[model samples]
Structures are given as C-alpha cells and as structure tokens.
Target chain A: MQDVKAHALLINEVGLHARPSVKLTQLAKRFAATIEIAIAADGPWTDAKSPVKIMRVKAAKGETLYMRANGTDAEEALRALADLVNRKFDEE
Target chain B: MGEQKNVGIVIVSHSAKVAEGAADMVRQMVGDSVPLAAVGGNADGGLGTDVGAIMGAIDKAWSESGVAILVDLGGAETNSEMAVEMMPEERRERIVICNAPLVEGAVMAATEASGGSPLDAVRATAEELMAN
Candidate 1:
C-alpha cells in the first residue's frame, strides 16, 4: 500500500473555521481513499472526512498542515486537498 | 428508479434569532440543496419553543427521506416531542428528535441530509456531537 503525503500552509486569515472546515470535509468525502490531517509536524492525525475533526485541529494562518491519504486514490486525494489549502480555500 | 431521497432538518431554539443563526450556519455548510427550517420563540415572539411553529417548519422541510429535529433546551425538546406526536402518524414515524447542540447539530445533520442520507443516519450523525 503506497500512502501519499502533502504539506501546505493555511493562508486563509480564519484558518479552518466552520465554512472552511465544511469545504475541506466535503472535498475529502469525494475521494475513495482514507485521508487524515495534522496541524503540527508531530501532532496527532485526524480524519479528514469529518468536519468536527478538522475544526478541532485549530489550524491557523501561516501554520503548516500535514495531509496523508491511503487507498486507490491516495495520490489524487492528497494532491487535491493540498491544492485547496495552497489556494487558501479560494478566500480573498 | 427514482432519485435518491434527500432527508430534511428542522432547528428548534428558544430564541428566533438563535434558530435563524443556526439555520444560516447549516446553510453555509450544506448550501441550498438540503431542505431546512428554523423555528423559535412562541406566539408572542419571546423566548421558548412554539409547537405550532415547529410543526409549520416541519411541514416546510418535509420530504420522502424523512426529517430530523434538533432542539436547544429541555422545553424545546418537550415541545418538539409534542409537535412530533401531533404530526400525522405516518409522518411521525419518519421524524426523529435529536438531543444535540443546536448549532453544531444542525450543521452536521444538514450536511448528512445534503448527502442524501436516510433520516436515522442524519439523526445519528447529529446526536454523535453529544459524545464529543
């Protein structure tokens, strides 16, 4: 099983609040892989498909988030989520 | 075959503004696809749940998939139960009253509903918030 990983900074001013967390989880649900995210470099990983778990990470702007995906679509999942975060969730 | 059923949600709170705010939050998460309604206060427009209003909102949010009601307090729960009992027997069978935080529960439940989950699954998702 080849797991994929990606890391990106949260540039959105509010980080993963309600709306952003929702967007993140919604995207995560579209993939068949199991995706997880961690805030600190050595922090515990939480389920990416759960909005509550994503919110609990308390990610803030300028902090890096670690994402890992495992399954048939692990690479795609990691790439998409990393891209979303890099885009600052499309926030202005 | 018919399209997948989209479960519905109703938010019940003691204050109208509170209910509306929670509904707005759920809308932000689930977008405009899910059926959702917020009912709060009483006939006089003060704090407390109104059974009539709850029933009305339920009707507005009715669907073949079913409906889940999330309440704020004990009184809201009691009144929600009463409102559910007053609903037609057929409809009552598909309605579930969930004891969860108003805002979080509404958001989670609405998200589940938007995914075309069944009534019980949506209710269970909302109630899961109580454990965390």
Candidate 2:
C-alpha cells in the first residue's frame, strides 16, 4: 500500500486541546494504518495514535495539521481523520 | 462495544478539589467509557492524603481489565502505595501507581483506556507525559 497524505485545519475553538487530542487519537487507533501528524508539511511528526504525543503538538486554531498514513488502510485512515478535523472534531 | 471494558483510573491528590477536577477533566475528554474515581484530603476534610479514602477510590474505579492510579505529591503516592498494599494479592497485582503528573496523566490514561487499551498501555500513556 502506498502512503496516503492529507491536511485539515484546526478550526475548533480551543484547537487541539485535551478533548480534541483524545478524539483524534481514539479515531486513529481504530485504523490498521500507522498515522503520523505534523504541524507543518515537512517536519517532525508525532504518532497520531498517542494522545500524549498528539496533545504535545499544541496546534492552535487556524493551524493546519498535516497527516500521513502507511498501511493497507492508509487512505481510509487519512480520509476519516481529515473528515473528523473538518467536522471540528464533532465539538461544535 | 457494550460489553467491552476499559482499564480503570483513580486520581489521588492532596486536595479534594484537585482530585475531582482531574477526574472531571478525564470525563470531559474521554467521556464515561472508562471507570474513574477520585480521592483526596484527610478524614477531617483538610489537606492531606488518606489511605482509606484511596482504597475506597480504588474500589470505586475497579475494573476486570485493571486500574492505573495517578497521584500528586509524595504523601499521595505513599498513601496510594499503602492502599495498594492493603488490597488482596490478586487485586494488588492489577493496580499500578503511575509516576506522572496528576491532571495530565489522568486525562491521558483515561483516553488510552477509553480506547480499550490494556492496563500497561494505559499506564504507559500517562507516564509518557512525564517525558514531555
């Protein structure tokens, strides 16, 4: 499977706070793919499946979160993650 | 998902408000998917750690999967240890006192647990925050 990539804006009011981080990690764990997220396009990424790591990203509102996934379900993982973020993590 | 059980979490702090506040954070972040309990203050309701209260909190948050405890300050940790020691041998084996910050660790641990992660994984997720 080829690596899949996507990006979504952190439009939530509080950005990637604890609640959003937990939602993102929980969603990431559901996929068989390995997902990594970064604040910038080419840079240090953190495991999307780890809440603590993702929370450390501290991506604020208006920041874009770049994600890459590699595995059989990579595409699906990226799509779902992007959708979740675009939906404002279902928070609003 | 209805039958699935997640690892439980217990928060131990010197202040009652702190423990409850941390538990509230966990609930807000992870929802009610994981068992959670908070215990703090002495018998007189002043600032202190109580082993009895800690033990009760452990019981309240008990899960078949296991329970991970997050404590604040040395007194809380020491009392939590005593509470663990006072438990049955089998129960003792399933409880762990995580060395991590109270609020952050509880939230992270509960998040991991809410995903149906194992006790060790939940504890590790919480403890990992200390590194950051």
Candidate 3:
C-alpha cells in the first residue's frame, strides 16, 4: 500500500461549499484509495468521499486544505485532489 | 435488473418556501441526477397542503424505482396519504410516505435515490433519520 499527502489552497470565490463539496466527494469516490481532508494543517481529517463531512469542514477561500491518502492508488488520488483544489474546482 | 432506475423523492410541507428550500438543499448535494419535486401550500398560495398539488408533484418525479414522499407535520401526512391513494393503482404501490423531518429526510432520500437505489431502500434511508 502507498501513502501520500499534500496541501492545496482553496482559491474558489465560494470556497468549499455545497456544490463544490459534492464535486470533490464525487471525484474522490472515483479513486481506489482511502482519502481524508482537513481544513487546517493540524485539524482533524474527515472522509473525503462523504459530502456531508466535507461540507462540515467549511474551509473558506484562501484556506489551506490538507489531504491524505492510503491505498494502491494513493498517489493518484492525492495528485488529482490537489489539482482540483488548486484550480478552485474550475469555478469563476 | 441491469439498467436500474433511480428512486424519485417528493418534499411535502405546509409552507411552499419550506418545501422548496429543502428540495434546493437536496439539489445542492445531489445535483440534477436525482428526480425530486416540492409540493406545498394550497392553490391560493396559503399555508396548507393540497392533495392535487402533491399528486402533480409526484407525477413530475415519477420513476420506475418508485417515489418517496416526506411530509412536514400531521395534517400534511394525512393529505399525502390521500394524494397517494388518488394515484393510479399500479403507481400507488411504489409510493411511500416517510415519517421523518422534512429537510433531513429529503436530503437523505435524494442522495440515496441518486445512487439508483430501489424504492424500499430510498424510503428506508429517509425514515432512518428518525433514529438519528
């Protein structure tokens, strides 16, 4: 099993709200890894595949989200999630 | 059994705004994949449940997987049952009036429906809200 971690800034104007959280969880489910995300560097990590948990994080714009993954596809999962957050979830 | 149809959800409340608001929350989480409709307020836009309005919303949200109806209060429950009875015999069996909080039930039911869950599973998921 592989383990990977990364930190990405939420640049979207609306941050990680309802729609964006759904997008993140849907995308996260596509991976074959155990993914978790946290709003603060040292904050408690929650399951990334759960939209409810992701929404609870309530990470605002410019806030850093720390992500961790463990599984066969951990590296791929972390890479894609980091890119999604960095791109502001492709929002205007 | 190969291509499964997703269950549909209906939000029934005494207030139109409450029904729409709950449906909006479900939309935000599940997007447009789930078939859901909000039924509330009377024909005159007053605070009451309309059997005809509920039936119409059910028609819009109809699916082979079935429809799960979530009501706000007591009267809404009775009205919803009457609305279900008014449905066609074939469609009536698939509809379930869940006993759960309006907003929470709609949200859970919509999420379960989007996953292509069957009628009973969707209704059970929403009704499970009372346990929490």
Candidate 4:
C-alpha cells in the first residue's frame, strides 16, 4: 500500500502559537496512524503530536511543512491536517 | 466525592517545549500525589498518532480511578478524540477530553480536584470546559 501524504504551512502572523498548536495536537492524537512532519526547506524532524517540537520549527511565512500519515485513519487525519495548515486554523 | 482519586492528565502541544512548559507550570501548582502525563508533537520528526505516549498517560490516570486527557492545538486536538474513541463503552465514560486551554483550564481543574478520585478529577475538568 502507498503511504498517505499530507502537508501544511505556517501562515499565521505569529506562526504556530500555543493555542493553535494545542488544538491541532489533540486532533492528531485521536488516530492510530504514524504522522511525521518537517519544514520543507530547513529544520529538525519531529512528530506531529508534539507542540514543543512543532513550535520549535520557527515557521515564518511561506515555510512549507510536509506531513505523512500511515496506518488506520491516515486519510482522515491527512485531510483534516492539510485543511488545518491551509486554513491557518482561522488565524489567517 | 466517593473517594479521593488520582486523575491522570495529558498535555499535548504542537511541540515538546510547549508540552514540557505546561507540564512544568502545572506540576508546581498541584500536589505531588496526582499523576500527570504529558505528550508533544515533536517525536521522530513527524506528528501523528502518538499512541504510546497518549496511552501511557491515559493508563497512568486510569490506574486507580480513571484518566482524563488534556490537549492543546495541532495534533493534540485530534489525538484527544482518538483516545476517547478507543475506550470500551464502560471505560469511555471514564476518559474526559479537555478542549479548553491545556496550560490554564485543564491544569487548574486537575490541580483543584486532584483530591478526589481520578473520575472526580476527570469530571471536574470536563465540567470546567462545559462551563467555560
């Protein structure tokens, strides 16, 4: 089977603030899939379910984050996560 | 309260720093007896389904009375729901999700109600969310 793929960018003015990160972290934890994400250009690798790691990304405008979810409910998680990154969680 | 139960707390953040930071803050206010578990989105360069971490925290809370999980934004939001979904019908009632602020609301409720059993603390945390 092919790996499920998803991606998101930090577009919020502040970019990945505490509140948004918290909300997103909880969402990702609901599934039974392996999720990993990283800044397309630069930064360290990290799990999607962690705010401390995600916040450390220091994503500015135009920074792209590549995400992949594999296992059960991967597609659902991918879609919502993609939307979250794109929607900027209404922070935009 | 039927019994003084110890509730488990899970703090999820977009990164480890945030979860750690929240954990640190909450640790200070609450007494040492209460069990607290914290997980972040910074594991292995990706973020998704931290089943181990989430389960560990939940288990800690459930050891005695039951467990209540709290999460921040990002993956934590979805993860909380997932944890609840995995529970058996009987156990499902014991797990509580605090959609409110992980750092503030959940911490406050957890600390204040820590005296009661895990179920009491979990209920208190949920009630706080509903009220707020």
Candidate 5:
C-alpha cells in the first residue's frame, strides 16, 4: 500500500502533553512502520513510537503535530495513526 | 455494584512511565475513537496507598462514563486495595478494580470502550485484550 502521511491536532485539554505523546509512540509500533511527529519546524522527531521520545517535546493543545509512517502496511498504519492524532488522540 | 454502564479506563502504577508506556500501547491497539481517561503516579504518588491517583482517574473518566481502575503493583498491592476501600461505597460500586491487572488490560478495555459503549467492552476485553 502507499505510505501514510497526515497532520493531526492535539485538542485534548492537556494537549500533546504526556498521555497523547505516549499514545503516538505505541501507534508507531503497532503496524511495523516508521512513525515520526513534528510539532512545528520540521521534527523534534522522537521515536514517535516511544513515549519517552515523544515526551521530549512539550506540546500543548491546539498544536499541529505532523505524523508520517512508511512500511509494508505503511498506508494502513498511517491512516490509523493520523486518525488518532487528528482526532485529538480520541480524548477530545 | 449497579453493573457497568458506560465505563472509562484508569491505570495506576508506581512508575508513571510504565503506566504511560502501557497507556500508549493500549491507545494504539484500542484506537483514539474511544473516550478514556488515565492518571498515573510515581512511587511517591503513594505507591502503597496510591488509590487516590487511580481514583482521580475514575473521577476524570466519570465525566464521560463509569470507570475500571487498573493498578500495577510492585509492593503496592496492599496499599492499593486500601485506597480503593477508602472510596465511598456508592462510588466504589461504579468502579471495578481488576487486580489481575496488566497495564495493557486497562488500555484495551478503555480503548475498546472509546470505540463506543464501554460496559461490554470492559467486561469482554478486560479478560483478554490480545485475544480480541
């Protein structure tokens, strides 16, 4: 399939804060893909699959985090990942 | 004790990082479509009597639905139980404490519920997240 690439917002009250960051990391690991999040100026690219990695950047709500996943099922992985962040990690 | 009717997921552990890690995994597997709330603690958050943090999670989730609290016990199991015991009996009934706990269980249950109604998902998925 094609690679999954999209931008999502962190609308949760806490923002990309810690919880959402952690969720993004795990999403990257799920489908055997490379996932990365950029808060603003190009990355601050953490594992995107590791909460620790994502937490490095302090993101607040309403910020745009761009995510991209590329792998075998990169397209599917990206859809789910993008949907998650776009949906404010579903906490919204 | 009224039985679960719309539930939220809560995770408790001495290590917030561990709890956070579990949360991440669960969220990925569960999808962000669900309505879930989580609160964690360090050992100092009251590892022994840390039910407050989990309770807080329940309260947060309560805004959306009932809650199922998951505790990651190292030596804190006893204290965790005590914390839950401290809750008002009425509130206790609304919350289910699963000591068979895995950080994943909470996430799975919460995630499944986030997809829609949590009562059935919590009961079914709480048992075997990997299976479902």
Candidate 6:
C-alpha cells in the first residue's frame, strides 16, 4: 500500500518534550504501521515508535511536524498521530 | 495489560529521595504499565546503598521479560552488581545494570518497557541517552 502522510502544528507549550514524546511513541506503538516523523515535510524523519528519537526531534512550539506511515494500518496511524498533535497532546 | 509482561526496571541511587524521584518520573511518564522499583539508602537511612535493598528492588521489579537497572553513582552500581550476582545463576542473565544517567535512563527504559519491548531494547533505549 502507498504510505499515508500527515502534518500538524506543534501547538503544545513545550513541543516534543519528554511527556509529549512519550505520549506520541505510546500512541504510535498501538498501530501496526511503521511510522516516521520529521520536523519538516521534506526529509530527515525518525522512527515514530522510539521515544528517544521522538524527543530528539526537538520540534518546538509553532513548528510543523510531518509524519508518514507504511503498513496495513498506515492511514489509521497517520490519522491518530495528526489528531494527537492537533489536540496539543492534551497538554493544554 | 498485566497478561503481557514488559521488561521491568529498577532504579538505584545513594539517596532514597533521588531513587524515588526517578521512579516517580517513570511512573508519571509511563504509568504503571511497566514493573518498577526503587532502592536507595543504607539500613540506617543514611545516604548509601544497601545490597539487600537493591536485591529486594530487583525482586519487586522482576519479570520473565527481564529487568533493567539504572544506578546513579559508583557505589550504587557496585551494590547493584552485588545484588545481581547474589541472584540465582539462571536468573542472573535476565537482569542488567545499565550505565546511563539514572533518572533519564529509568524514564527511557520504562517508556520502552511500557511498549512491551524486551530487556535489551529497553536498556539500549536508556543507554542511548548517554550519547546525547
């Protein structure tokens, strides 16, 4: 299947800090999709399932974060991840 | 959730508060999904590590998936080593004392464990922070 892709603004106060990163990875792991995240739409994506890599993304507040996933659950994974970022990780 | 075992984690520090604090961070981030325990201070409640306490913490955090331990200082590492050594030979291989920053390592390890990752992956995730 073609990779599913999505992007959302990092509206949370701290962006991809420890808590949010943990939340993201935990959510990503629930799907069978092989997901990757990038600070920009062009390149340099990292594994969405690794909390450490997600934290290292360091995408600050107001930044746009891109995500893409491959696998049977790709579309669902992208939707959930986009929804998560849109909700500001439920931090606000 | 309890039906699926995740790698357990043990935090060791010279100060009880430090160990407890790290464990608290792990819980706050990962919730109780991963087995966790903290051990610190001497029997007298002084700032020192006790082998018995470490051993107990290991037992408390034990899982067939394995246990990854994080220590703060040299003494804490030494005591953790002794604690691991004292365990049954068969069970010893399942436990590892990670050489990573205590609080960060515990948090990372617990996060990985919460995902039902194996002990090596959990330990690797925790240790990877040291390179940053």
Clashing pairs in 5: A25-A49, B1-B93, B34-B114, B35-B114
lDDT of 2: 0.91
| Predicted complex 5: DockQ | 0.04
List ranges where model 3 is wrong by over 4 Å. A40-43, A70-76, B1-4, B21-29, B43-45, B81-112, B115-132
How close to the true structure is residue B120 of candidate 4, measured as C-alpha lDDT? Answer: 61
Report the lDDT tens digits of candidate 1 across residue range A17-39: 77778778878877889999998
Residue A50, candidate 1: C-alpha displacement in angstroms = 1.2
Q: Summarize candidate 3's per-residue lDDT along B1-132 as a digit string, tens digits.
A: 322377888999999999999988988777787788998998899999999999999999988888999999988999999999999999999999987789877876776666566788777767766763
Q: Which candidate comes out best when scored by DockQ?
A: 2
Chain B fold agreement for model 3, TM-score: 0.94
DockQ scores for all the models shown? 0.36, 0.86, 0.19, 0.02, 0.04, 0.81
Interface RMSD against the true structure, candidate 3? 3.5
Would you list the C-alpha lDDT of every candidate in the order shown? 0.85, 0.91, 0.83, 0.63, 0.61, 0.91
Number of the top-ranking candidate, with TM-score as the measure? 6
TM-scores for every candidate against the unseen true structure: 0.87, 0.94, 0.71, 0.49, 0.46, 0.95
Q: What is the TM-score of chain A alone in each candidate?
A: 0.93, 0.96, 0.93, 0.79, 0.80, 0.96
Residues forming the 10-long window of minimal summed lDDT in candidate 1 chain B: B1-10
DockQ score for candidate 6: 0.81
Instruction: Give the docking tier of candidate 6.
Output: high
Off by over 4 Å in 2: B1-4
Please identify model 6 stretches exceeding 4 Å from their true place: B1-4
User: Which one wins by lDDT: 2 or 4?
Assistant: 2
Cα miss at A25, model 1 (Å)?
0.8
User: Which ranges of candidate 5 are over 4 A from the true structure?
Assistant: A1-92, B1-6, B31-35, B42-49, B74-76, B99-101, B118-121, B129-132
Which DockQ-derived CAPRI band holds candidate 2? Answer: high
Each model's fnat?
0.09, 0.87, 0.13, 0.00, 0.00, 0.70
